[model samples]
Target: MITKEKILERVGGEEYLIRHLVPTFSSKVRKKNYKSIFSEKDDKPSMSIYKERGVWKFKSFNTGHQGDVFRMWADYYGLDCRTQFKELLELIDQEMCLGLNAERKSIVTPKSIFPNSPTVKDPAASFPSQTLRIEYMSDYESFISRLYLKYWLQYGIDQSVLEKFDVKQVSFLSYTANSGRCLSFKYFEKHQVVSAYHISGRVKVYIPEIAFSFSSDPYFKGQKKSFSYKNQNKDDVFGLVQLPEGNLDYILFTAGEKDCMSAYAHGFSNVISLQSEHQMPSEDLLRVLRSKTSVLLCCYDNDEAGKNASKKLRDSFGIVSVQLPEDVKDIAEYFQRYTPNDFQLLLGYGVQQVQSITVNPIDTHRVRRLSNTKRSKVKSYLSNKFNFRLNVVTQEREMSTKRNPGLWEKINVNELRDNLDRHGFECNLDLINCILKSFFVERFNPIEAYFLTFEGNEFDDGKDYIRRLAHYVHLKDPTPFNTRYWYIHLKKWMIRAIRTVFEPEGINKHALILCSPKENIGKSYFCEFLCPLSLIRYYNSNPVISNEKDAQKSLIRNFIINLDELHQLRSNAHVIKTWLSQRYVNIRLPYQEDEITASRIASFLGSTNDVEFLRSDLGHSRWISFEVESIEYIDDEAKYILEKSWEQAYHLYKLNPGSGELSKEELLELSQRSDQFTTKSTEAELMVQYLTPSTKELGEFMTATDILRYLQEIVGITIRLNTKLVGTSLREAGFDRVMHSDIKRYGYFVQKGLI
Candidate 1:
């Protein structure tokens, strides 16, 4: 018996508490935040847990649940406070016995809640400890009754199967003097019986009304009731001993002992069963199965509960499931309904047949060595000798009178590379790189051609597309002369989005920035619409990207990386500019052993309220900025229209991708206008307003201090700056220094068209 204080001390405090409780609740601790592991869609941290005052405390933002560690653990196990305390005490006692050689300590008995009662030991303290014991029958012949054998035979379990598993029947007397019988299935471990499962065959005696009035009815006199022993080692599966002694090609798992016997009778020697439908195999048993068997077949009953259990097993262990015929439910019923030959045919039909490929390790290693210096030779060798080909399929197919949308399916290059590596291949990096590069090039050509087809059509015209999109989102064009100007900006964005999908390499060379100082302009929503939902990775909070390693993390697969709430990022424009211009990026996935160079496939999109977003020195080549002023609420109708339009554009692009080129004049105008609208800094803005054009005369030379004062007086803007800082700001704003010979002062001259 242990007290709460003693238990806490023995279990090594709150960290241990958290470690124990989190797994029990099917939660995971990632970067100190506890989150649900069951759902992939739930990316947010479910609870914030921390240790305080020598105890663990947690608050669940998802459920509005807050409590100390003990209460949380109790809630997870569906236990009341008192019962949970008792359980915790027992758990701590077990841990102390295992981890430390602590002497037996007296438990603190809590005072009774009842007013008159005294303190006493917890009720759980008196509970019997479960132990495994094997009981042998002294009268085996007498116990194996005719009724018991007949009962089993009715269920298609013959005497031979019963003898093979060493099952028995027993009669016993209960405390109530009622007589009963049960069929017992003995469980063996390493050829020794450690436990047994008993199926009761007891019937209640119904006395007549006159006999019930008597103190003892004649029918019930000297009757003995039956009792079954509970097995402590319940984790072990029931029929492992019956499994064949060599490598099994496939093992059929059933839901009960009878099912196991039925399967064995039907010529499935490689069969195992759980104690009941509700019990799953233990980890040790699963590991053994994995090592010995090539395939696992879940042959549970056809009922709802059994199907659910089978699915759970399939997901957890990656096993294939076998469903019975419509009329049959369990293995016993199936044996009753069909002949052995029919059962074999049904088993063959139920098995999932997967094609297997075998590779020679020496040949793979030789090919890998050849790939490093002679990539083309290796490619030719693999193509001719191994019949390797990059498989890419069309994105549409004719179905009846209408065309159905098709999916992009290609040979998995990573899996191929892994297979090569597993076969003792060296220089796998070079081999994989060459193969993937070829595959991408081969795959993307058709996609690029499909996008180009939309250029000439009226419905897919760049201007018409943008106009429809703007109207759907309720966006008003800023300039009256050409709503087409806004359309041109949007067209550039559409090209970028298309390129992100079709061009896997160098797609990160530019990023799109949607800027607005006001909220509810649908900036983020538009970003989501441009990319597929599966390929969009969101950063609700800014991630560290100041270094190469940090920058590498942002290139997650082929995703459109969304840097939402861009104002929170402490990174300056120069870092972002460098990141966006890279053709290839270094990636070190968390589980990988070495860093690998991957083609830059991720496209960055950021939304922010900051008007002057980038540094003055950073050029506009890598950024396409859009200033959205429309702040109207988008209703369901508008959302549907937007989705439909975007889908049309995507399908058109996939059908007819254009030649990957942009008009030089159009691109230059769009870049300049985009820079003016969103990318210019405060200092650049002021220079654009004040500086004279290059055709006009240059402004007068003045000291930095004097220029600052003039700007303050003219613009009604106050800025605190020293001469050095002012000079730096001016240089960044495209201003140059000129000498005033008479005054002997070197002051900055504001060149025309500097902005």
Candidate 2:
């Protein structure tokens, strides 16, 4: 019972065996280039050894000879690796004193083979594999290794079939044995040492890379087993992941992974394996698979164990067994012996045809008039078979349509009808609607769903956004402008604007206004570009606030509202402020039964040519005004910066929900800065010139009417005699109103200046 796994453990590892058996013919083994050890006339050094996925391998450019340590040993001795693999293992054990065979006591010295070389032994040979421990390790290439793929291709499992099932080509794989030995294998054309079998579950099965007829080989006589597994998981069902979505007319269950792949190679896509014939599928798995296919059939190997297991499954779960011909061992062999069409013919004879299960045959004209009882039965059947639900955020109906189930996709009415027709249920649009009404429906908040779709790189701490903003837009705030201060506030405003799309309470009460006297500076384009390309449909450039109904509808549908002409809104500053301050809009939408309140997700951005866009002094805080020197058109770099800024803002918002909100100090600073954008207030200017703050001991109190009378008479100024304007101007000049109880009115406490 001496095996290669046990001998490899005793000899440290395969790497040691390669260094000992194969000597450097031209130069030292540590050099980059070495003479070919297999050829006598290899005058040029063209062979070199390299490690791939922890397995030591060598390649010869001169002769195109390449393989792992075991393959190299076989090539050096001029032996066929497939038939004489047992001899290869025995030779290594005899050379390394591995003690695999107690009867073999003689050990050969390396100096005898290579006469000019010294017999040096590595001290750490016993634990060489431990130096690079590969536990649950694997690597994938674009295609399966050509050498390993060549073996399976014989059974008709081509590249497309393997790729469809996600069966990857393992470049190299290493695993630890139960005896604490780490064994690694690499795939090469010269001789593939191991095979990698990828199934649906978490198991990784490795077998002999090349299948050999062991009847003539004395070492492997009477032995058919060739499997060594590593990193096996709880899931036993193989090929389940490769099943197509929705219920199939029929699905064939095979005995092993190879057989399952072989069935798929041939047009049988709906096929799976339970790892072995004896291992019955779990009850829950069987129930799920039964719902996914109309008919389930089993095709095991042509042997006693396979037949007994097939019968047991048929008796217990009522699975139909497709017995193979006595000459063929399994489906893989059957496909090799006969054509795919032959196998298809055999399947029809072995498995019974699936019969329709409908209680009544419907006439084409009466499809719409199906009885309530029959319709209810169809609905119940669909509900029990598949999970159907509606995504309120995406506004689409979807059903669990995956082969293994649990994967949902948008429902296509026509596709559903076709699938139903195949199942013996004559369905129409009306009937399908009736059946869908019974499906579970649920709603989700659109705002949360919209923001959750962002998946990309986030900018660093908003500084990148502030830098880009400073480079693009310049604020006309007073002389000696603090670029850092204004840009930081603008960045905060941008983040808050983004949050406005997710928050329904309308936390952002301001609109970003870009002003420039020159025309066509890309101002409008920048405003439009503020909305991400993914949500470009939700960006409204031609916004009309005059129509209250249309405005409310826009608030619900659009995420970004571009106020095109900012100066035109100056006439309706009061109304604009009222509209901007609304948290939710209550309006009757088209087709809506009655008035319904809708949460607003729109954040406003505007562009105007007029420098003096702010006409009202009271609503200046609601507009973040900036005079742009220039705005560049949308490009790749600009798009990246804008996208990353939103991503970063979202990241910060999720981490700190209130990160976008301004503090009390910031609000006060913003209010002070907003004054520079406001138009010159003539009334406030005249009031400040005519009035002064009262001293603590000496002051006179006057009403707004009295102040207006003094400005028209005493100051000799022609002005409108409006008491409310006079009172507002006085307050704007830093005057506090005093409640005159004696006079039953409110007046300001001030003393007249030089006037």
Candidate whose lDDT is highest = 2
- Candidate 1 error regions (>4 Å): 1-467, 476-482, 504-510, 534-550, 556-558, 612-623, 631-719, 722-755
lDDT (10s digit) by residue, model 1, range 76-126: 433455655766455434322221212233444333323343333432222
Clashes of each: 18, 0
Give all TM-scores, in the order shown.
0.34, 0.45
RMSD of 2: 28.5
Query: What's the CA RMSD for each of the models?
Result: 30.5, 28.5
- Evaluate all candidate structures by whole-model CA lDDT and list the values in order: 0.51, 0.63
Q: What is the overall TM-score of model 2 with all chains considered together?
A: 0.45
In candidate 2, position 352 carries an lDDT of 59
